[model samples]
Target: MFNCNWGFMTGFGPGGGMGGFGFLFNLFIFGLLIFLAYKLIQRLSRPDGTRDREDSLEILKRKYANGEITTEEFSRMREILRS
Candidate 1:
């Protein structure tokens, strides 16, 4: 014969004894945490906020310095960006 503490088990365990909302509430909280975690990870992975406006300007200057782009093209693009 198993000496089962049914009262305590039902009260704390997954016996749906602490009202039906307990398990559903815990599940909703868990899902919310997962959603927030996913959004945080996505936000951290992108370079949008991490990069500044000057980054592109610096890169364009480097390309001009390296002779990858002509001076006219560089000046035109730089003026366009500055405006």
Candidate 2:
């Protein structure tokens, strides 16, 4: 004789509750997916070495503005960067 009870199938059987662990597991997976997507987007937004070159130029400008480099040195580096 087959038992007709289906409570276990619905997590309603004796000692069947997951005690909220299932919700936590799903939340963790969702957060991991979101983090991975953000990282992928950030990585794809930069094209080739342009971003690095621009960043270097910006740093160079900052150094010149802060008086960390002489006019001749700044002009020399600026010319080097343009090439």
Candidate 3:
């Protein structure tokens, strides 16, 4: 005689015998994934200089050293950045 698995098929199904805990667990996992993605997007959207810790003063120095700006312009820009 073949018997039907009503206990595992009818109300609860095969997602473990726990009543509604399986659904709750899946929901928790989905929420955690969303939270992680939001955090990742926020981090990626930020400017690279903030992450690299490059300051405006350092950039001005590099520009002056590269001869991209005159000495007077470099000093003025450096003063502006320091303020």
Best-fitting candidate, measured by lDDT?
2
lDDT of 2 by residue, 1-83 (tens): 99675533434334546635645655677799999999999999977788888889999999999999999999999898877
TM-score winner, 2 or 3: 2
lDDT of 1 at 62: 97
Q: How close is candidate 1 to the true structure, as a TM-score?
A: 0.42
lDDT of 2 at 52: 80
Q: For residues 1-83, could you state the per-residue lDDT of candidate 3 as single tens digits? A: 99676433333456555658755766677799999999999999997666343477778789999999999998888776655
Error of model 3, residue 51, in angstroms: 5.5
Model 3 deviation from native, Cα RMSD in Å? 10.2
lDDT of each: 0.76, 0.78, 0.73
Cα error, residue 73 of model 1, in Å, equals 16
Q: Tell me which residue pairs clash in candidate 3.
A: none
Supply candidate 3's per-residue lDDT for 36: 100
- Once fitted onto the true fold, the runs of candidate 3 whose alpha carbons sit more than 4 angstroms away are 1-17, 51-83
Using all chains and alpha carbons, the TM-scores for the candidates as numbered come to 0.42, 0.57, 0.42
Question: Which model scores highest in TM-score?
Answer: 2
What's the number of clashes in each of the models?
0, 0, 0
